[model samples]
Target: MHKSFSLQMGDKTLELGPKPLVMGILNATPDSFSDGGDHNHVADAVAQATRMVEAGADIIDVGGESTRPGANEVGAQVELDRVMPVLDALQEAKIGKPVSIDTYKAVVGHQAIQAGATIINDVWGFQRDPELADVAAHYNTPSILMHWDPNRDTSKDIVSEMKRYFNKSVQIAEDAGLIKGQILLDPGFGFGKNYEENFTLLNRIDEICALGYPVLVGFSRKSSLGKLLGVEPKERVAATGATTLLAYTKGAHIFRVHDVRENYDALQVAHATIYGPPPAKDI
Candidate 1:
């Protein structure tokens, strides 16, 4: 049987698991490390999302703010302006996939859900804004809670720290009335983790996956990969693919990525090679 988790986002139902879910990255900010201002315009954003869907992206993660280390924060209105048009255009175009809002502000989360987004991919893990959990609960939608620390640095033993963070975030989500299956957790690959620490976490991701909620891994073009391959952000596609395979073996069910088609194609081959075709019993 396929491991399944149900996420009710507005009028859509996302059945995630068994097979890996690929979330394509779409940033509307002008300063994101990759594909930032490229998708700021409504037409461009819609086109890019459409292309990702065609490329096998299960979800398109739309973010208005740049979360790369040392990125300057934008106000909620700016974030809203950056994301709303894309959300509107995507829905208007009938993209036939869930649009996850990459945000932490409660107002933006609420507005994004109201504007047709179904998931909140909060990097702060709902700790930055407590109301974020409430927004997810209110919409009966799911939110992606990433692991974080008090100092917000992954310089130490981040695996243990990530477990504790996931525990707390899960409690908060449940307390806010999100059902058991409506919460998703991410290991937050490079959010605060250093080069080695990021790999350590990825290697031991099953520790987080054991928590029961679906695990989302965002290793796309992360600096850790760059540092490992000694390449720049633009050259991390192969590195990202390697990590995607490693993460799946470690029980990651969702992958947040930049190069969707490459990662998707990589996963297809990896899955078939490892698990063989779907059971002949199914046919």
Candidate 2:
């Protein structure tokens, strides 16, 4: 297993796999499903970003559009307008953590990088906008490529599908001149899979992680969790925590989540019990 790896962006390095890195999700859109319209305002967005960072997040994933099911498509300009203020504010305030822009549009991703985002998180796995990969290459920005098939295929084994999906994403990145080390793979928890498929993907996350790329699990308040527990997305913190622990043990290197503090605390205990003590001089 690739137990340890780090992605460098300027002077910052995000170490992975010693324990799962917490990537707090900050959607500055009006329909992000969970925090939709909550942080649409600049001040609210900045404050929430600060709060999540202070609560022990390793990264802040800021999105301008909502990827919730049935969500309407947003233009690049609309997306940019929604997220720029938040990005600018965070940059001005020096949030002290790498900010990842969650966008699949090339123009938006490029602008976000120029505005100070360190990583590009494309939920379409680099397929929706081929230019998105080019943006990453141009900026040499680290990327999180999520496994998303618009078809939502549930007929096959999801883990195998994930491998195929990631393989394609890697090729797309490479074809655009993005290096292997600059790419991270996400299982796309609730993106295209059904309830059973999501859990199955979680249960066999090791196969996905075995791809030798850092594996990021974004199962925070996902619809799959809500459906399984019969709770709403906002009411699924406990369920999210439970999945966080499971994903941690299966070699998930990063968690794209909403409840940062709870996942941080859960991982600390799991890290201690499963991975044992930290290095004598390490935190």
Candidate 3:
């Protein structure tokens, strides 16, 4: 896999060196599928974010809306209200880490960048709102395009469709004035995949990673794990850790996860076993 990668958002810069990155999930929503309503308040959000960073998070991803199955949609203002306080609190606390705004709305993303977010992680992969590509370009923030479609057709090959979507997403970003290096691709595990397809994507992640872009995979507490192990979201941490190790060895550059320390620890061992020893500070 090609190694050079860099991203800039607000005043923060993220460079993917040798080891994979641990992006801690900070859902500031009331109804996330996993860990929802856990960090809705400012105090709770800050506390959780602090714990994540202390536990070895390289980045904090804050999302205001819950995209869980059968969840209600929140308005932009509500999302803004839910997210700004936490982002502001994190900035004020001086965590010295890059903050990622997990939203597809351009206005919400704009407000997030104004409040100190450096990354835009859109689960729709810019297929929802083409204007979101413009927002990422406007702010010059690094963009993560995760494969997702509520009505995705399962008849076709999922990985090939994901590659097609990435190609289109890259075009959208470039057309909107965003550079290729500023873009990252995500297969979006458990978003629109079936039990077998999720693992198929995982097994072929290295092929996707070989397409010449940084790959970010989110298998943490996903329903696919539950489908495989007959466990619930909270019980999927060990499964998530296993997936993390597998994804890392397959050349995934980032792991968006709920349990930062466990994933970080697993990646530490993976790095040692495969890529050599990481620095004490990195683990």
Off by over 4 Å in 2: 278-283
Over the full model, what C-alpha lDDT does candidate 3 score relative to the true structure? 0.88
Give a tens-digit lDDT track for model 2, residues 1-283.
2378878796778787676789999999888889899999999988999999989999999999898999999999999999999999999989999999999999999899989999999999899998899999988889999988967466777777778878888999999999989899988888877778888888998888787888888889999877777888889998999988888888888888999999998988888788686656645
Q: How do the residues 74-101 of candidate 1 rate in per-residue lDDT, one tens digit apiece?
A: 8999999889888988889999888899
Clash pairs of candidate 2? Answer: none
CA lDDT, every model vs. true structure? 0.86, 0.88, 0.88
**Candidate 3 local lDDT, 1-283, one digit each (tens):** 4376877655556888567799999999988998888889999999999999999999999999998888998889999999999999999998878899999898999898889988999988887788889989998889999888656567888877788878888898899998887999999888877889999989998888888888898999999899888998999999999999888877888999999999999888887877667466744
List TM-scores for all candidates, in order: 0.94, 0.95, 0.95
Candidate 2 TM-score versus the reference: 0.95
Candidate 1 TM-score versus the reference: 0.94
Total clashing pairs in model 2: 0
Q: After superposing candidate 1 on the true structure, give the runs of residues whose Cα lies further than 4 Å from its correct spot.
A: 1-3, 150-156, 278-283
- Model 1, residue 247: C-alpha shift (Å): 0.4
